[model samples]
Target: MTVPALYRGLFDDAALFPPGDLPLPEAVPAHAVHRTAWYAEAVGPFLVGAGRLAELTAVLAGAPLRVALVLPDGAGQLAPALADAGALSVAGVELADPDVRAAVTALDGQLPAGVQAAVELPRGDGLPAALDVLAGTPYRAKFRTGGLAAGAFPTETELAGFLAGCAERALPYKCTAGLHHAVRHTDPATGFEHHGFLNVLLAAVAGPDEKLAAEALAERSGALLAAAAHDLTDDQVRQARERFTAFGTCSIVEPLEDLAALGLLTAPAPQEDR
Candidate 1:
């Protein structure tokens, strides 16, 4: 089955930081391989940190590269950084800082045309104010799905609230971290629970209703999630993607392999025309 339109361009390569932290040279080639992989369509741009922008340019040696840049905390000038990275296209920028609002506001007039931005908001009392500010801007929202520790993962309630707020405001968002697999499950070593990308996709498609979305985020049944994914009509898939966008993952192969195992992508499923 072929990967659906809802999931195409879902996994952004984030091998440069955190858990995977592959070397820049190694990651550049790996990203090249992924762009040619059988599941290539399901992949997105390489996520590179602002600090590594110069390094990435050096490694690619004049080959054109597309990247989603993660800005450093307290960053003030985005244009100067991009100016130094040769042949690098900044597709998106992930901004998370104590002064997120100011930084985003500062970037208002300086951003390259068509370059997207995702602002990561705190998940508590400050959320609404942040959402309110972002709702009026062209920026999209960003959420952290999981981290190295269990505390990094937000509860179902928190996740649901975030989804509902975005839905209510008609804000599109992207997720990063802890979505290594296609289904929700407990990590044997860390014992930290993880959210499934498929589950999140379904929840986004299910609309912003808190109760229903929370259930989808907490769901563990791969078969049920697979069925939901299989049942998506073309337009429904597009609608879901418009809101959910794509997520960042350390390994693109993991999600693709898991989806393939679930038979949701074993062969091309019949398409339904409107």
Candidate 2:
């Protein structure tokens, strides 16, 4: 099945990250399989932290793996990580630092040609300043939508503010953590409220209106959200995706299941068949 342009490269494979922490040895082969699946267009590059480059390269045995290198320790690790990424196709780079200015300064002219970079901004008071710093550069923005702790998830109002800020600057952005599903719903086991990836797409479609974006984010009706998404014009879809970009998800299968259930994607075959 041909994935829609809006959903193509939407789900970055983060199987190596927490919650799904599949060992690198296993994760590499699993990622290779995902890249060849029917829904391959929906999958983006594999995400690996800078610290794990050695371990990742060791397991590859010369097999090529595309990756979004994450530098959680801050900009100081960017240089050595890139230097160490032998044979790994570094498609993108992500840096999470409280000092957004410093991070931007450190990342200036550091990446190879064509490798995109995203600065994970700190939420709340300093967010605007961070976005302002990134606005002057080519690097995109990254937001943390959910995490292991309940506190890691941003409220609709907070996220709406972020969407608005980025839209105002015409800055592109991506999201990570807690967006395991495609629609807004409460996790039954942990009771952690997770933001739906579709809701976020709709919110981005809402543009710079924080109130409308927040309303979109808060919408839980699957049919309503799916209908809105389906009704989007080709240009609207382009504009929304241009600003929102993609998100990191641990389980590619779960998202495929959600999209299929919403009628956004054809139901994929069983795990064994895939």
Candidate 3:
């Protein structure tokens, strides 16, 4: 299965591998991020400006990259910061406000050849509608992403609704933030506890029966792929929770080594992907 690495690209460092390495196996770096007025004041618009966009594109052009460029899906205008960025294949819409429709409509075909129009389901039926429109065109299906703005992780039922919606629509989705750990582990790097949001893999395991799938995901307190997350008793769950919690990405000692061995993330995937 192809696992797309969810990148919260705030850090200056790489997420999946060492910074200097270009390719690794079975992982695609997702390089989309957001900016705020406060951020501009703190870091300056130069990083979020058009020049930055061009530079970003150049860096990822051959890196098996799926970059999520945040278009100001509000004013219905591509920020001058993005105007000269030149050819983005994946667009991650920031729907903190409810102006997504206007934003995408304004882009129309200007949204690069084969570019995806990702709409966060902030409000209304816009995302489904937008996905439907993008699918009929030559463009690949737009991504159904974004849920972190709500301040709390999704409840089991809410997540179940999302999974059911994805299955019904046949859309493949990905996420960021709150999902930093490989499993339901604490950030060994930071002492704070992270909510285990591993329902992603359980949806894969349990298939499409929503209730069965949801119950399947909710039962685990760790990454779903690990042996510990498999079918278990309440007593086992209670006792194993601490053990299931991972210490850090350091625990990823081997698989990452294997991906590096395969040279997966370096050069871009061949033409079929492009």
Best by TM-score: 2
The alpha-carbon deviation from the true structure for residue 243 of candidate 3, after best TM-score superposition, in angstroms, is: 30
- Model 2's alpha-carbon lDDT is 0.91
- Give each model's whole-structure lDDT: 0.83, 0.91, 0.37
Residues 159-190 of candidate 1: C-alpha lDDT, one tens digit per residue: 87888888889999998899899898999999
Best by lDDT: 2
Please give, for residues 157-234, the per-residue lDDT of candidate 2 as tens digits.
Answer: 999999999999999999999999989999999989999999999999988999999999999999999999999999
What would the TM-score be for candidate 1 when compared with the true structure?
A: 0.93
Q: What's the ranking of the predictions by TM-score, best on top? A: 2, 1, 3
Instruction: Give residue 177's error in model 3 in angstroms.
Output: 1.8
Position 195, candidate 1: lDDT: 88
- Which residues of candidate 2, in runs, are more than 4 Å off? 267-274
